[model samples]
Target: HTSYVLGCAFSPNGRRIITADLDNKARVWGAETGECQLIIGEHTHDVKCCCFSHDSKYILTSSWDHTARIWKATDGTLMNTLRHEAGVDSCAFSSNDKLIVTACHDKIVRIWDTERGQLKHTLAGHQHSVRSSSFSADGNRVISASYDRTARIWDANTGDM
Candidate 1:
């Protein structure tokens, strides 16, 4: 039912799991029973990463199609999309849930306002693809890891790399 698993995440409550695949799909599964609960197949290219919101109310999936989409966790409803200039590699919710961090193959990490879907910052410094990124506990800083063999800390609000 899929090509290859790229990334996966457990819902905040730990009851559900979401898997991103190269098949251009993301599937929600019952963690305990291993049952496929929902299938999200809207992306036109390989889905790179998938994750749950901090409150477990939503799911977000990033893709090589240059979009990171948010969906309702319970019903699989499309909520919002974060589009980038290049293939997005990963996305994650801020610790406080006010923002999302998206890393891309364009050697940049972008911070997006979750509620407004506005671009916050574009952190540019890495020489290779930004493999992943996340916010610090205070949500004021960002940490990004790259295939460039370096991990950097940036100012989340300013995009200072």
Candidate 2:
């Protein structure tokens, strides 16, 4: 990438790496050979974060283009796109890799069903842009930090504070 590399993560098994870039692309690389294996480039704006699922079979990415996407890790096939009302700042997969969480500039934290790519919950309460989010170890709760000067926790299944 000619521009900034915002984030990068190694796969759980340590054989591959994924990177998020300002060039509107996410790239998968072979860790051993250091070669670019695949370019997952569907986002129209800068990608802010990228991560591999706990089992290392899937990739999840967040973008300033107001979407989060999931892809097949082995071949870089696009699996799902989760749309948001504003730029997405971050995203993560649940412990079991069955759920996804995203933080957005719209002040909302969203929970998504990984299998159907459906919106499962909209965690609303932050007074400013949500900057980051992650699921609990059990995947039953979500924690988010916001520009609103607060960090909040919510029930991942219920979207409750």
Candidate 3:
């Protein structure tokens, strides 16, 4: 990365690492060798957050480009793009890896179907940018924290608080 790294995480298996940078790029690296394995430079703006799926088969990245993307961890194949009305601040996969949750600068939190790459629900209520979001351990709920000094929990499928 030619710019500052905004986020970095180790894969579940501990064999690989992923980093998001201000240069609009996310790279996967071999943990043991410290070698770059894959570079996903698809975002139009700075990449803000990056993480690997619990199974270590996928990578998720959030960006200021107004989108969050899912990728094949090993080969960097773009699997899906989760678009938002504003820059995405954070993203995470459900424990089962079947769903996704995204927090956006648009002041909304959204739930998405990971495999289909489609929107499942839009959680609206935050008065300020939603800074982060995550799925419950069982994947039945989503919790989002915002710049508004509030955090909300919603039913993952219904978008009901």
Candidate 4:
């Protein structure tokens, strides 16, 4: 009841809820009882968004720290760190779970290889900050929305402009 919740996401199974907070923490709770099950707290800045991986085995968070992190949902272990030029606004995994896309305040979108934890490509064009991004239904492309008053489609595999 005292938690400063900022973003909330339901697990794929709907039994658990994950919340990201301005307090620089993320917590997992029971949806029915509001009982906290786990806490993730490695972020150095306020967490803006969080989500459970498709399999529910991992938690992904984007923050003002200019990075997005992936954690083991079961134990809160840090698994990966995805960096950006400016604050990270949001992130999402491809439908296949093999790639991740992050929208950043630097006005660019970046794709990462989930398994290797390496930056795959940067899609640049927006004149202002990129606010959000999502994978196409086929996972072959990404759509990015920006504060620049424009939206863009990018080749997910190549990061083409």
Candidate 5:
């Protein structure tokens, strides 16, 4: 974990916790005893955001290193590393946890296949840095909010804005 903790999220069952820190790491913690569980130190810069998959089986994090990463929630094992042109500001897990959406300072929103670790779609329409992105309840769509004073909806499958 970094020197300054940036963001944190709790598992769906509330048994564990994950934190993103300026130390360029995300850490898994035992919620009950506040004991440090696992340390993910792959990011080369500050970690901006971190989140858990809906089912609490995975952890996702975005960082100033211009990347987002996924890890196994139970053991902190890295599953994937997603690269972007600019710092990754935020990320979201699809309803089924099979996909991820990453919003970055490059003003692009990228969708990814979790299992295969492949790029799915690049939803590029924002005129400024995208602050955050999310998968819709049904997981058929994605929404992004940007510093350009716009919130856009997109077709997750086709990358249509």
Candidate 6:
């Protein structure tokens, strides 16, 4: 159906596809047939990114509206809303699935507790907008790249340098 897709992610099992769009919506669909399934639409601005959780039951979306939202994959129910100081550029779930990290135009990187939707820590050092962020393979640290011409490493638990 020519979805206005901005980003797409496959479920862990590869059975479903989750997509985010500039239209401020995210949808879940059948991977093989491209059949539209669930649709999530609460974002006030363009959805820039989305990802399926490790278990494939949830979808995470980052938007220009300065927030990241978590949704139930099956029914598109809102699960959690994560806010940042500025527009969120990207988000990633930790490999262990316990934490979520978001990079924002506010020049900060933030870590959140996935289940509780609580702010775990904020990593601040970038002099310009943060472009991307990710958790280390060991899940003990986070790495962030910024337009500030630098990349930083922080303790995952404390967001310390």
Best by TM-score: 2
Please state the error at residue 42 of candidate 4 in Å.
Answer: 0.8
- Estimated TM-score per prediction? 0.95, 0.97, 0.96, 0.94, 0.94, 0.93
Name model 6 segments beyond 4 Å from true: 1-4
lDDT tens per residue, model 2, 16-112: 9999999999999999999999999999999999999999989999999999999999888999999999999999999999999999999999999
Q: What lDDT tens digits, residue by residue, belong to model 3 across residues 132-160? A: 99999999999999999999999997999
How far out, in Å, is residue 132 in model 4? Answer: 0.6
Model 1 scores a TM of 0.95
lDDT of 3: 0.93
User: Candidates ranked by lDDT, best first?
Assistant: 2, 3, 1, 5, 6, 4
Name the candidate that leads on lDDT.
2
Kindly provide the TM-score of model 3 when superposed on the true structure, using C-alpha atoms: 0.96
Greater lDDT among 1 and 4 belongs to: 1
lDDT of 1 by residue, 56-149 (tens): 9889999999999989888888989888989999899998788999999999999998888899888989999999999999999999999999
Over 1-161, each residue of candidate 4 has an lDDT whose tens digit, in order, gives 24577778998899899999888898899999999999898999888888888888888899999999999989999999988778898888888788888999998899999877899898989999998998997899999999989999998978885
Q: For model 2, what is the alpha-carbon lDDT of residue 124?
A: 91
lDDT of residue 46 for candidate 3? 93
Could you give candidate 5's per-residue lDDT for residues 84-154 as a string of tens digits? 99999999899999899999999999999988879999898899999999999999999999999999999
Quantify all predictions' global Cα lDDT against the true fold: 0.92, 0.95, 0.93, 0.88, 0.91, 0.89
> How many backbone clashes does every candidate have?
0, 0, 0, 0, 1, 0
